[model samples]
Target: MPVLIAIVAVGIVVVVLVVHLTGGSHTAKIANEDAAVERFLIDYPDVEVRQCFLSWDRRDAVLELEDGQVGLVHAVGVNFLTRLVKRGEMTARAGVSDESAVDLETGDVAWPRARMHFADSAMARTVVALFDKKVDTTDNKRAA
Candidate 1:
C-alpha cells in the first residue's frame, strides 16, 4: 500500500513539474484576437477605431485609428523568427516555390520599409496608447 501511494505521489510531482516547465497549456496562453480588439475599444472610448485586423498565422494585430494612422500591435520578437528563417532555414516546405524562391529570399532579406505618418504628435500618442494595450509589450523595451 505504501509503495502504491509513493508511486501516485511521484506521478503527481512529475505532472506538476512538466506543467511548470512547459508554462501552462497552449489554450490558456492563446487569446482570442477578437476579444483583444473588444478590450481596446472598451478601454479607449475616446478613440474612434476604424478597423482591427489580426494576422492569420500569429497573434499580431493591426488597428486603424480614427485620425487615419494605422497602428501595428504585434508580438515584438515574432519578427525575430522570420529573420532566423531568412538566414537560411528555407526548407522545401518553408513555403518556397521553385519559381520565386530567389526573389522571395531577396525580399525577405531586404524587407520593405514602413513609414508611419501621424497627423500630429497627439494623434500619434493616442494610437500608441491603444497599441500598448493591445500588444504584449514585455518582449521589447521599445514598447515602453
Candidate 2:
C-alpha cells in the first residue's frame, strides 16, 4: 500500500511538470500581420497573400489573397485554423458586448464561424465589409 501510494504521487507530479513545461496554459495569438500571412500560407502555399490584418486580441487574422480571395487564421489551442472564404460566403457584424468586435458566420459545417475584436469600430467595420455582398441592380432590371 505504501509503495503504491508513493508511485501515484510521483506520477501526478510528473504529469503536472509536463503540462507546465509544455505550455498547458498558453493561449495562442496571431502575433502580427506578417505572422498571420505566413501561417495562412503554410496551409495554402499555392496562394499569395496580398495583405493581412490582426484583430485586437490577436485571436484572429483576416487576410487578403492575391486573387482577391479572403482567408482567415484563427488561433485555437496554441495552433492556427486557416480557411479560404469566398466573397459573400460570410456574414459579419459586431458582437453585443463590443462595438470593436466583428462576428463572422460562414455557414460551413466544419468551421462555421469566428469572432474578431479590433482596436476600433472602423476596423471592425472594415472586416465586416470584406464579407458583405453587394446587389447587382443591373442584373435585375427589365427592358421596358
Candidate 3:
C-alpha cells in the first residue's frame, strides 16, 4: 500500500522537524551588559557607549551612546538585531505596560516594536525616559 507508506514517511518527517526545532532552543540572548555593548559596537564602530539597560530575560537591550544617541538590541527567534535609532524613530511608554515592562514602538519594519521587561519598575520608567529626549530631527541618519 503506497498510500500507507507515504503516510508513515510524512509522520516521521514531522516528528523529526518538531524535535529539531524544540531541542535546539538554547536560543541566543545578550547575556549581560557588556555583551550587549559588544554586539552594538561590533555593528557600529567609532561610537562611545555610556551605559546599558538590559531586559530581565537578557533578550533586549537599550544603550546610551555619546551625543545622546540610542541603541536598541532585541532577540528575534535565535538571532539579535541591533539598531542605532534617533529620538523620533520610536516611542516608549511605561504606564501602559506591566509594572516592570517598557514598551517601545519603533517605526522600523524589520523590528517595529518591542516590549522589554525589567526586574525593577524604576528601570522600566528610565528606559522610557531615554526616548523622551528632544533633538533636531535632521541631525542623525536613520538607525543602522
Candidate 4:
C-alpha cells in the first residue's frame, strides 16, 4: 500500500510539472521573445543576432552573436521597468554607442533600440534568430 501511494504521488508530481511546462504562459513568453528577436533582425539587416538568452528573474533578454557581441533587450510592458524609469532608476538612450548608430540615410530605422556589449552565450541565440539562423534551445550547450 505504501509503495502504491509513493508511486501515485510521484506520478501526480510529474503530471503537474509537465502541465506547468507546457502551459500557455511559457509558450507566450517564448513567442514574445521570438517576435522581439525577429523585429530586431528586420530592423538591422546588416548585423546578425545569434543566440537568445532569456532571464525570467530580470525580465530581460540578451542576444549573443558570432562576432563576439551581445545585445540587451528590455521587455516591453514590464511594470517594474516602467516604475524604475519613473523613479529615475533607469534612463532611456538612443544607442549603446554612436559608432553603429542607425540613421534614415544610413542604418535601418526599423530597429527599436539596440546596444552593443561584450559577447556572451545568451546574446548569441538572439543574434542567430535575428539572421534566421538555427537557435540552440538546449540549456547546457553554448552556441558553437
Candidate 5:
C-alpha cells in the first residue's frame, strides 16, 4: 500500500510540473522577450538592435543586429550585465569566448560570448514564433 501511494504521489507531481511548464500565456512570453530586448539595448547602446530573443530565465539573450549579425549576451543576471558595462569590461567589440577561456591581453576577465540555450522546447518555439511574426510584419510594411 505504501509503495502504491508513493507512485500515485509521484505521478501527481509530474502532471503538475508539466501543466505549469506549458501553461504560460502568449502575452506573458512576448512581454518577457520585450524586456530582454530592452535590457540588451540598455547594455549595448551603440549596437543597432534589429531583434532579440531572451532565455526563459532572462539570464541570456540572442541579439540580431542591423548589419545581419547575430550574437549572444549573457551574465549572471540582468543587473550583472550593467555592472560589467560600468566597469569598462564590456564593449560592443568584445568577442564571445568560452567560459573556460581567458583573454590573453586583459588577463583579468574572460571574453564574453553570446549564445542561446533554451530551457525547453516550448521556449524555443516561442522565440521562433516571435521571429516569424517580426519577419512577417517587416515584409508587410515593405510591401506597403
Candidate 6:
C-alpha cells in the first residue's frame, strides 16, 4: 500500500509539472482566444469581427472580417503584430481560388504583406456562421 501511494504521488507531481510548463490544454487556448476577441470587440465596437484564428501558441488572434479583410491582435506582452490594420491599409487580393487561403496586401509602403490560411473546414464554416449572424443583427438594428 505504501508503494502504491508513492507511485500515485509521483504521477500527480508529474502531471502538475507538465501542466505548468505547457500552460494547459486546448480548452485553455480557446478560452484565451475568446477573451482576446472580447477585448477587440470592445475596442472596435462598430467593426465587423467575423472570426478569430488563434496562433499555434495562442499568443495572438488573427481577426477576419466579413469583406475578406484581416487584422491581428497580440497579447499584452507581445509586440504589435502589424500596423496595417490600424492604418486601414489591409486589402484582400483581387482573385483567389481557395477560400481557405487568403492573401493580404497593404497599400502603405511600410506595412508588410501576409497570407492567412484556415486549414480546418469546420472552423471556416463556424466563421461564416458568425459573420452571417453579425450581418443579420446589424441589418435588423438598422431597419428598426
**TM agreement with the true structure for every prediction:** 0.32, 0.76, 0.79, 0.30, 0.35, 0.37
- Compute the lDDT of residue 126 as modeled in candidate 4: 36
Over the stretch 1-144, how does candidate 6's per-residue lDDT look in tens digits? 999999999999999889877855323332466666676666666667666776445554667765545556654332333221532345544226656544556464654554544555445444334323233457658899
Better TM-score candidate (1, 2): 2
Q: Could you tell which candidate, 3 or 5, scores higher by TM-score?
A: 3
Give the winner by TM-score: 1 or 6: 6
Identify the leading candidate in terms of TM-score.
3
Model number with the top lDDT: 3
Better of 2 and 3 by TM-score: 3
The CA lDDT at 51 in model 2 is 71
Stretch of 10 with least lDDT, candidate 3? 135-144
lDDT of 2 by residue, 38-113 (tens): 8888999999987777998898988877666789999888888999987787888877888888889879887787
* lDDT (0 to 1) per candidate: 0.41, 0.83, 0.84, 0.42, 0.48, 0.54
- Model 4: per-residue Cα lDDT over 1-144, one tens digit each: 999999999999998899777762242232455754665565445556565655543345555545544444544432211110111112222223442221111132443343433234344333333333233356436553
| lDDT of candidate 2 at residue 3, scale 0 to 100 | 100
Q: Per-residue lDDT for 1-144 in model 5, tens only?
A: 999999999999998888678763112222465666666667666767676656655566656666444444455421334322211222222113422211112123554344344555555544334323123357668899
Lowest summed lDDT window (length 10), candidate 1 = 80-89
TM-score of 6: 0.37
Those runs of model 2 whose alpha carbons end farther than 4 Å from true positions after fitting are 1-17, 135-144
| Per-residue accuracy of model 3 over 1-144 as CA lDDT, tens digit each | 999999999999998889778865556888899999998988988889989998999999999887687998888778788889776568988956387898888887866777889989999977887788675446365542
For every candidate in turn, the CA RMSD to the true structure comes to 15.6, 5.2, 6.3, 16.9, 13.8, 11.3
Clash count list over all predictions:
0, 0, 0, 16, 2, 0
Q: Candidate 6: how many backbone clashes? A: 0
Ranking by lDDT: 3, 2, 6, 5, 4, 1
